[model samples]
Target: MLLATLAGCSLWNSGSSKPLPADLGANVAVLGVRQAWTARIGNVGTLPLDVHVAGNVVTLASADGVVAAVDARTGGDLWRATLAEPLSAGVGSDGKSAAVVLRSNALVLLESGKERWRQPLAAQVFTPPLVAGGRVFVLSADRSVAAYDGATGRKLWNQQRPGEALVLRQAGVLLAVGDTLVVGFSGRMVGLNPDNGSVRWEAPLGSSRGTNDVERLVELVGRTSRVADSICARAFQAAVGCVNVARGSTTWTQPASGAEGVHGDGDAIFGSESNGAVVAWRRSDGSRLWTTDRLKHRKLTAPLLLGRSVVVGDDTGLVHLLSRADGSPLNRVTTDGSGIAAAPVVAADTLVVVTRNGGIYGFRPD
Candidate 1:
């Protein structure tokens, strides 16, 4: 899953700080990693982009308006298409269909290299659109959630809500989990019916803690992960916590300063803080397990728990591998010089990462 804005100290800055130079941790090698292959998709422009993974197909869209699907293992293109306008959001697809939002607020859908349908939006879209159950869902910047008929590009229903005075340029995501459509708004998560825009349940993950609006921002981490009965989410300068998706109640809440959100294994939840500390906590009790600030202030992407290893990307184009048990750096690898902007994605045992400049790499640890 890709996230919009990790958010800076404030919403307007958009975490645009210069990433500190790469620091290769201690020289001991604990894991053997091999680069499987590399490919050039296209430049992703200045915005944070995401690569969509469905089954074994990895789909990508570029700021240059090019979209392609490649074999996740071979790094070979299966199909490719180009748009006349640059894309504003990452590519979203469920294998059978692909969708992208153009800079012009037009949501374009494609299938088998041919244009399927295009729907215009009233506001710009920053997050990856959601495609499920033959319906396309989008959360626009204007704080409106709408569903569109996937087959005919017809507008189904739209739910409008008031948003904050200022929101992050890096948008949040739209998730479809089972029968419920999960959406992260300014400070809460809402579960809505995928068929209609009706709200099924709403849960507050975090609340405004600051005295003023800017400082009071409590936005959902947006990039949420599910582990068994738990639906875990994090919020900026708010809390990292989970709720029982079935009951729509809070499971646990821990004060946190991370904006990128949390990832969970069966027993533990992992996150990379805004300050660059990779921390872990027990899944059941929300107890702090361990934390390592070795990569502090590096502008890290969210952490990916790969078995016993924790994988995270930095703004310096370096991927860091750390011990899941104690948060120790085990190994690191360098990619295209443009640095990594999106989280490293995994399909099976292979890890794929995209560079800001357009290089994609597949890595396997043995």
Candidate 2:
């Protein structure tokens, strides 16, 4: 039985007052960027919404279950669909079929903006479904993994792991590396055979150390950085590690106190610390290469490596682009002023960011 739910597990620590966010005194335009196009959806508020990008098409959903596929190049809607209920998790698509979990624990699949089928789930899901190979995979809060036929809503298989006394209410890892379905169970990154629910390999990144249930929570978060066969992920506020999927072995693990995910190029991995400091680590050995406290106490989302810049959104709706090599500020952009709701993503050379008030703005090099 699940004993407790830890919401926004990475954002808070007890008994300590947060420092004021660093003052962003003036706008310095070093790198030129212009808002290319803008779109709107329902207020996302604090949802764990992942913006799914397949080529130039970007699929995303609102808290009220309004899913839309926007052309990343032109900011035009390819299609839009609305479900009757609010969404718990969603907008996973393969450019063909999209899957989202309703608040009622129903997995609803859509094709070309039309509802294909809906199936009920036994547990709550916060991670966006992984839709690949004509299958929809969901990782629920109860530590269960299930797959369904993408076309017919028929249950393909279900695998349940022993539940922890406490679990996070935020999104956890659920991604695909080649033919294997990789998921996070507690602090271990487990690889499973996608065809049938079978364990391929399990690599531990963090372990329960503290006495209390809250302190022992070490589940992996989403938005992991993958470079070829090597995938790197953050184990909550415990550690950052990379696993060689091909060999089913751990590459490296370094202590990381971050609540968000990580992103990187092949050489270095970048993440934002819980205190809002940005850090860069060597991908090969997990060595700390650089750290920037420019955004401290700002409440940052996960980092996104785009070209020569590490893009990160803050709680005030400002997206900062820093030099990937040395963590220097390159440029900063603004959004709806309601704060950024999700991490910034790139599609067709346009940087797309969603605001808490449901503003989707696309930016391009000016």
lDDT of each: 0.79, 0.90
- Candidate 1 lDDT tens digits, 150-170: 999999999888766555566
Off by over 4 Å in 1: 1-23
TM-score of each: 0.93, 0.97
Q: Best TM-score goes to which candidate? A: 2
Q: What is the overall TM-score of model 1 with all chains considered together?
A: 0.93
In candidate 2, stretches whose alpha carbon ends up further than 4 angstroms from where it belongs are 9-17
Query: C-alpha displacement of 112 in model 2, angstroms?
Result: 0.9
**lDDT tens digits by residue: candidate 2, 1-366:** 444767774437454675789887777777888999999978898778999999999999999989999999999999999886899897789989999999998999999999999999998888999999999999988899999998788999998998577887778999988889999999999999998989999999888888877887889998899999889999988899999999888999999898899999899999999988999999999999999998988889998999889999988899999989898888898898898988889999999999989999999999
Clash statistics: count for each candidate: 1, 0
Model 1 local distance difference test score: 0.79
In candidate 2, the residue pairs with backbone N, CA or C atoms under 3 Å apart (3 or more residues apart, or in different chains) clash, namely none
